[model samples]
Target chain A: MKPRVGATLASTTDQTTVIVVRWGAEDLDVTCGGAPMVDARGPEAGTSHPADPAQQAGTVMGKRYASEEHGVELLCTKPGSGTLAIGGVPVPLKDAKPLPASD
Target chain B: MNITVLLDMAADGFGDRVVVGTREAGLTAQALRARASAGAALVEAEGADAILHLAVNTPAFPVALFAAGLAGVPLVPVNYRLGAEQLDHLVGNHPRALVVADERQRAAIERAGLTARTPEEFLQQTRTPAPHAVEPREVDPDSAAVVIYTSGTTSAPKGVVLTHANLVSYVLGTVEYGAAAEDDAALMSVPPYHIAAVSNALTNLYAGRRVIVLEAFTPQDWVETVRDQGVTNAMVVPTMLARIMDEPGLDRSVPSLRSLAYGGAAMPRRVVEQALREWPAVDFVNAYGLTETSSTITVLGPEDHRAGGERLSSAGRAVPGVEIQVRADDDTPLPAGTSGHVWVRGEQVSTAYAGGGSGSSLDADGWFHTRDRGRLDAEGYLFLEGRVDDTIIRGAENIAPAEIEDVLQRHPDVADAVVVGVPDEEWGQRIEAVVVPRRGVDLDAEALEALRATVRGSLRGAKTPDRIVAWAELPRTPTGKLVRRDVVAGLAR
Candidate 1:
């Protein structure tokens, strides 16, 4: 699927929803619970998919999942029992680099 | 990109953490979200076009900010210190606004014939659970998030419109989400009307830090609050910093204060030096910006302050995502170290003013003419000379008041100083100064002579002040910005 910053996506195999925070150079094969995600209009519209037990690693709300090789960053907007992956590779939680807060 | 999304992120990232007011009684991130939802429901029910807050910085302030976002109404924080007639004039402009004001301010809001709520009532109403849950509406990132009236020193006040995307861009570029330690707390002293206050609320919340507001600021009270709250980070304007630094009775020691950020106006070199000496361990940041720039565009970080040299006087380098350039009268870019008009371009710069549809302030290229005169050093450090409008033309030579003011500040007996151009028959304009003497120092004729000689020696004689007057205190806006118009009018009289 094509990744665009601020675009919301919902898992096809679970109730996971995420927003792309950063896009990569190429289209991403992003998936959750062993199924590709699709554009989500509302919460109810994305929750009917059943998760595959093998890929139910779960996603944490507000945590950012990043693929370094793909240069993509997705922020979890809703928690679900679905592991977020890109091209069958599980995405790692992006570490926050604390900068001096500009207020 | 909507401002509410930041609140949503906070609620999701640290739902149980206290993010507003005092930690013991403050609303947690989750609680705040619910309250804001209820408040948004109220706003929608009322069909308000805007949420105007005429109150001091308090717990309700942050709630109103988020609620307005959720309601898709721009939040307008009016200066609580405006006089009756002035307040009436400003409030009258927002006839469709739902005003949340303090007790004393209710009369003005009523006079404007608008719906009003007290701070307590606002809090309670926002906290009251709705009979049925109100679904949040999708907010356009380009929509107005906040409308702050510029503190007009030389002309009538104009509203500066900051969009949700502008603020979100600033926060996303500057802060790492949920970056603060679980116990980290920020002491917010700037008034709610100032851009610093609004930006501080959003950025600190996004960083997962609790914010405690000081309703009124006294040097001793600020220090005590920092100590009492175990505040790790705090923000103050230059005037506030000067007061805190010079207060002889202050204990001046805060073990928990890890970072102190100051902006709003030019910081005196002496004040910064004294503060460094007083608290060597604290990280001091000198942020330089305007309301139109969404708070800060450049920052002199702690490392630069620690190194201490000419850079201490600079506004530091431009922050990531902001590009700054100095331009000449012909709009050509000036060479490095050559002072000229400061121009900035960034995602955070607001391109329009209220009722003034995209004025010439923003060029076709998206670059905003800051109307500030400054120069970037060879190393890219920005040194603010003064406002372009503040230039004093003496016999065809343009002189910046900041240059003379800096020299006056170097005087040991001078506590504060401001230089302005005065009408003169001989020269196009003559430079005049207003000085606040240090406490207990009698500024006699001999001392005045010494001050004049100091300025003449350091700067050209034409650039020196033609006349100097003593004032107990200069006229300043609520946010500590010098009201130069008042000073000039007073001098004229």
Candidate 2:
């Protein structure tokens, strides 16, 4: 699916949800828990594949997953038993670059 | 598109980090989120339509903010310093709100006959989990996230409607996520009702910086807190800066202070220059914007101050994703170096106000009429002349009081100055000024005459003040904005 900033996506297997925080201009294959993520409402009930062990590294709520090569960032809104991947490659968590605190 | 998304990200990114209050026992990211989650459940259980925060800035303030967002309702932060009649009128507007207030503000809540909770009690109630995991609804981007009341210096206060999109755009555009150093702490001195307070709360948290709020402000206390807390960044109004710069026999050293931002009113050239000289290691930023614009649209970075000269007074260039223009009365675009009405169009700009729907002060093309008279230089530097309403018409010539007052403030004897237009049978309206001379210097005729001559030398004779009086101090809002109406009445008296 085309990855866009501020767009929400939901996992097919479980209740995992994520929002794209930053992304490059080009479209990329973004998936959660070994299945293609659908819109905020998710896909029809039975269309999802059963959770796979290799892809079930599991996601923690509120963690961010990013692909530096593709310049894509996703914020996990819900936890699930699936890893975030781009083009079938597992994406690594990106570290935050701290700014001077200005209130 | 709910505001809670920001909080959720923060909790997940650094759940154990202290994001609010003192570093030792401040509320952690996970704690804040849990409190907000529990508080949202309370809001739902009470069936409240909105959350009305009528207290000073506290740890509970941020919890209430995100809780209200998770509850799918607007958070209305009202000024607690308003007069009885004004306070009553504003309180009456929110009958279905959950009133969260302090002891000093309990009267307004009691008068409204609504169930109220103190900040401590509010925090305690949110400690327990609800029957089920409270999930925040997917709110629309255009839903009202917060409604901030204007200072109402010229007229009755009106609620400025800021949607989730307006505030989210501001944070995402201006701030990078988790951008603060692990030990960085931000000292916030602005009041709870100000837009800076709301925006600052969210931005500082999202940046993973610990926030320290000074419920009350005094120069001594502020400096001491900075020194003790090792605060890395801070924000202040012009008056607060002036007070800090002029505090007598005080230790002005803040070794950890790296960035200081001043806004909410025009900064005198002398004060800013002194600040830059005294704290050479510190970076000074001049952020210019309004509540309707979601805080800052233009920023004069520290480099501009080092440039010195006339750039000292310039409000600097627009921030990213924002466009600024100067327009004549007929909506014609003005050329650079020509003073006219300032207009701004941007995603962060909230062109909507309560009672009046979206696009009230904005044109059909989405440009918001700032109602501020200013000029843009060829390099895109914005120089504010004053408000359109503050212009003095003297013999058909539009004279900006800020222009004359700026010159007056530069004088060695002048500590503060304000120029106002007094009704006159001749010349339509004559320019009158009130000057607050430096301490220990009497406002003698010689000093007043020298001020008049100085203004006359730089500006046209018609622009000079016809009558300049000496006042111990001028009336100003709590946020350092001059009360022009009060000044006009003072001149009349």
Candidate 3:
């Protein structure tokens, strides 16, 4: 699915949820624990899906996972024991440098 | 994209951290979240479309903001300083709003035929169990999160609508998650109506920092609050910083202050220099942006202040998600160092006004044309040269008033200065300046001529002010923005 920015996605295998912050690639194969995620606002959001235990690397809340080549970024809203991947390649956690608060 | 997500993140990440009020008796992130739920219930019960904040800085400000997101309504913060007529006109726009007003605004709220609650009353409501259970509702990202009315120079004030997407993009792009230490606190002095207040509340809370509100701003009160509250961070306007420097008989030592950000208007070089010398340990940031944008777009960091040459006067580079472009009168893009009109484009920029008034709206290309005339240096640092409308157009040449004003302010005898264009038969417009004298020195005939000579030495002869009038003080807004229209009217009289 080619979801827009600010779209929320949830994993069926567990209580993993994320908000899409940036997107560029046309085709999306976003997976959590080897199962495709569904729209968080859809009826199937919290339903159970088949899971593979080997893909469980865990997603952390408040951590941003990104893939530079695909230009994809996601902010983890709920922690779950599943790695977030696009087309089966795990995205790395982005290192964040804090800026001085300038209001 | 809802702003409530930030509150939820803070509550989930650092539930026990104090995020609001006094350090001794402040609300933790978890408590604030619960209060937000109850506030949302109150809003739902009232059937209000908006929460109109007609008061000063209070804890109710944040509660209403978060509650609005939960109820999928906009938070409209109106300036309480407006007169009766202006207040009535503004209050009319939001008839179906739950107004949280102060005691002085009682008559205005009553005149509008709306029931109003005090900030204290609203705070108390949040403490008690909600009348109804409220589950956090997700709002459309494109919906308005805030509506801030800005007083214009020529027309009635217009409301700048800030969307949830705009605010969320700004917060996520600029701040790192969980950045603040356990004990870090921020002292907020800007009024609740201003975008600085809203932006600061979101940024500080998301960073897991405590925020203490200084209801009204006095230099002595601000200094004492910083020391007493253990404030590690603070934000102020140039005028407030100037007053802090000028105020005497106060212990100005702020050892706990780690960062100080000042903006809303241009900073006097003298005041900035003195502040840097006085607080050598504090990190300084010069933030520049408009109410149309969420908050800051360009910032001169602490390292830039330490480097401190010509860039100190500049507005520094654009923030991560924003792009700045300089264009000529013909709409052609200008290269670096060429002064022209400034245009900006970013997700955080909301160029649209609520009820269309007179102002620049966003173009088809998503670029918001700013009234400012500025230039970017070779290294992409922005140097603002006053407003384009404020530019002095002579027979042919367009002159910037800020250049002359800077020179006038630099004169030893002059404490403040304002350069304006007055009507003239020979030139389309002639340069006129108003100068305020330093405490002890008299800006007599000799001193005025000396000040003119200083401007002549720096700029060309034509750029000099033809008539220099001495005034006790120049007119300005509370945030130090010049009331040029008022000044021109005063000069005409």
Deviation (Å) of B284 in candidate 1: 0.6
Number of the top candidate by TM-score? 3
Poorest 10 consecutive residues by lDDT, candidate 3 chain A: A94-103
The DockQ of each candidate is 0.42, 0.25, 0.71
Provide the DockQ value for model 3.
Answer: 0.71
Kindly list the per-residue Cα lDDT of model 1 for residues B1-493, writing each as its tens digit: 5788889989987899999988889999999999988888888888898899999888889999999998889999998888798788888878998889998887888888886788899998887776666676667776889999988776777889999878987887688778799999999989999999999999999889999999999999999999999999999988999999888777988999999998888888999999999899999998999999998899999999999999999998887679999999899999998999999999899977877874545888989998899999998999999889888999999998999999899788899999999999999799999999998888877778778889999998898888888888899876788888788898998
Task: Judge candidate 2 at residue A97 and give its lDDT.
Answer: 39
The deviation in Å at residue B435 for candidate 3 is: 1.8
- TM-score of chain A by itself in each prediction: 0.83, 0.81, 0.90
Backbone clashes for every candidate come to: 0, 5, 0
Docking class of 2: acceptable
Which residue window of length 10 is worst by lDDT in model 2 chain B? B353-362
Checking candidate 3 for backbone clashes, the offending pairs are none
Local accuracy of candidate 2 as per-residue lDDT tens digits, B22-103: 9997999999999999988888988987899988899888999999999888899989899988988888888999888888
Rank order by lDDT, top first? 3, 1, 2
lDDT of 2: 0.86
After superposition, candidate 2 runs with Cα above 4 Å error: A1-7, A10-36, A44-102, B357-359
**Model 1 quality (TM-score):** 0.92
